[model samples]
Target: MTHIVLVIDDDEERARTAAEQVTDLDWDTDALDVTVLHVFTDNVEGATISQFGPAREARDVLEAAGVDVTLAETSGDPADKIVTYAADEDADVICLSGRKRSPAGKAVFGSVSQSVMLNSDRPVLFCPPE
Candidate 1:
């Protein structure tokens, strides 16, 4: 069976870089099928404009790197959308870029990475932001 890798990220640059890295590794191994899903969440205030740019840029980079990708823009809770997509796609692996949150922030606001990690049945790979 062909394994499908799902990349869930909002930052374009980071997403693209991750996609490229995965693609490079896949090429070397010839073991998996990599598909980048650039999910843009609209629920967060100002996230559309601020986050969309990076997400789009990441898509461009991934395309340039010759990775097969599907771009999706959704307006709702990001974590929910990501989990739903992963389940719907039956993804073998979900890759995401995780942002560090302050102790208080994490305690009070929670993190998307944490949500996905907890909710997803498939394996999740988190890439810390540079």
Candidate 2:
């Protein structure tokens, strides 16, 4: 069966990490279809997915690893959009980066990763970020 993976990418390091993690999975690369989703909070410069470094990196790395990859873009609250998109795509799993945050910082400003993890029915894989 084809397994769909939704990678919510926002930064180059995290995007590459998530893509690499997907490649490392025991599943066959041919059976895995990955979509790198980037939610735009602001696009004052009129940026597109092609112009985004994170999405480009994810696509390049995954493709080089022999995994099918695509790029998707949207504008909204990242957590909500990620969950919605995953469901829309019927994704088998979701991948994203979790920044190291202090307890107080997390409490004050909720994490998109944490919110998605709690709200998404699909399994979520969180990679590392600075």
Candidate 3:
């Protein structure tokens, strides 16, 4: 059976990290289908997800691992959209790059990964950015 993985990140480094985590999964690479999702909260520039460097880079890494990859985009709140997409895609797992932020930093800045982890029902694989 095919395994669906959703990778959501805006930056190239974080996206690459998430892709690496997906490649490390126990599932067979041949059976893994990955969707790289970029949530644009405010896209005044009118950019496409395929044009995003991070999504493309993530695709390269996953493809190198022999996993099928697709680039996707959505506009809205990151946490909300991410959770919606995960359910919409019926993703077996959601991959997110977690930044090491202090509780105070998170309280002030708000963590997307944290919100998604709390709100979504799907399993989440958090790749810490070290």
User: Pairing residues by index, what is the TM-score of model 2?
Assistant: 0.92
lDDT of 2 by residue, 7-115 (tens): 5556688778877777777878877888888899888998898889988888898889888887888998989999999998888888888888999999999899999
**In candidate 1, what are the lDDT values of residues 9-49, reduced to their tens digit?**
65555766666555555452334545555455445564543
Off by over 4 Å in 1: 1-10, 27-51
- Cα error of candidate 3 at position 84, Å: 0.6
- The true-versus-predicted C-alpha distance at residue 113 of model 1, in Å, is 0.4
Question: TM-score for each prediction?
Answer: 0.71, 0.92, 0.92
- Candidate 3, residues 91-122, lDDT tens digits: the string is 88788887788999999999998998999998
Colliding residue pairs in candidate 3: none
